[model samples]
Target chain A: MTSLTSLASSRTPADLLRTSATAVWIFLVVATVTSWALGTDHAFVDNTTAASVVVLLLAFVKVRFVGLYFMELKDAPLPLRALIEAWCLIVCALTVGFFLAG
Target chain B: MTSDVIDAPASPATAPGKKRRIPGEEGTWIFIFGDMCVFAVFFCVYLSARMADPAGFAHDQAELNQNFGAINTVLLLVSSLLVVLATRAVHSPALKRHAPRLLAGAWLCGAGFLGIKALEYAEKVHHGITPQTSDFFMYYFVLTGLHAFHLVLGLAMLTVLIRFASKPEMSRGQFIFFEGGACFWHMVDLLWLVLFPLIFLVR
Candidate 1:
């Protein structure tokens, strides 16, 4: 399969931008639906490790959407995109890792 | 002899536009990275507070209105769609004429979000569940308040885009500013997606 950036850039500018937005919307909807379903307490507050993991994974997905499409990383040069993604992964991993470790 | 080859468009010898790079765009990414760090600290604080007093956190969390939170998430999702459509419309030769509609739709969606959020706050206040009532409430107020403030700013940015869209002489380069603002707005939206589950949905 063609790489994501190559596919995006190959489209007319209009399609590229539309695909970017629609992808995020779809991702958010799926996340929200999954979260609502996995929620143990619809009317109350309950915390389960399963729910926590799901939310964390959703956060990662959202981060990817913002970094790739909204921030135009899809069109960015390879080194710049790599730099941004690397920093984000380190920050997120450290934060979540510290919490989980503690 | 090789000069002709060097003149080719694909040749590395050719200078790119302006032959200069912008560091401000690079700086914005760093700024965003810093913002993420601050949010992480807050996340840690939230987690620890809950861990120390899971019972209290759960009680306080129960006081939240999930219906409103769900509605707001939907609104933000729609607004994200509008922003995407607007960005796409700008690039269309035929649909470019309707760019104003696309942008206006985005602004409307953003404004709708603020309106709904205010209603949610008002409902909470009416129920006597003020932020100071508990530590969970405190975090909820601060986090959601900041998010709402960003929405307000995002709406204002959309207004600016609308103003430019109405102009006859606006260039495609000008849309980059709108795109930058939209990117920040999307970040705001993404933050809320995380907040909704962490604060309202999960135990």
Candidate 2:
């Protein structure tokens, strides 16, 4: 496995773009656009509940990506990583449940 | 880990041995997590209020400019990407020269976010909107306002980071401090990631 330190040592612009951090950035940007499309007034879908749920879930997922990749939590100690993961899951679940409950 | 251990070229944290390590100081993580918990409570409060008046909240949410929220999201994400790259550069001798520039770019992105947020707030006020407008606008202003305060702090942290990155050589303690600052900036981005959808998008 390529270590994060090694990935960060990437020299050129192409090498930089090919790094895992850049890959995660691309994923996050696409996810943001997806959430925007689904939840905005211009949304094609008619189901507000479904759209809201997806948007909320996507937001949390993006949060996790920022924590894991951008913040280097993926390379962190297991206990710390698990704690953050649990936080993400629990908060997301509660948000979804509350949204659906109403 | 002590500074000596961290300063070692073959430090377990960065070596190929794959020893697990926290990105920043343990105290920093504790503070980060604590701050997150507080925001989580804020989120729950907002949701509970929204549930009480879903129709009103949804109606007001529609009035928000999703474009501003989306653009701010992009700006923060890009800023975070720069910070991530800058953090990486800090760890590599060959790339170290670029760290200051990368951090500056991140700082610029943060400034862009603040600029857009100011415009958003002005526009809202121009249309006779304020925190006292309604429950929804109240939460919107309060939540985003608190978030903007954190962003300002993060920008200050980035300024310190740029100064540190400009140094020819950084002590391991300074490096750890840099990592901690970078993590804090990412936390700002993380909060906004949820705030955008919650306040602007979610019905």
Considering every candidate listed, which one attains the maximal lDDT?
A: 2
Candidate 1 structure quality by residue, lDDT tens digits, B72-128:
887777777776666555544444556677778777777887888889889889999
Q: Which candidate should be chosen as best, given DockQ against the real structure? A: 2
lDDT tens digits by residue: candidate 1, A33-95: 666656545423355665666666676677676666655575666776776577557645754
Model 1 chain B worst lDDT window (10 residues) = B4-13
How does each model score on TM-score?
0.78, 0.94
On a 0 to 100 scale, what is the lDDT of residue B113 in model 2?
95
Winning model by TM-score: 2
Tens digits of per-residue lDDT, candidate 2, B42-134, equal 999999998899999988888899999999999999999989878767666667788899889999999999999999999999999999999
- Superposition error at A77 for model 1 (Å): 3.2
Model 1's alpha-carbon lDDT is 0.64
The DockQ of each candidate is: 0.32, 0.65
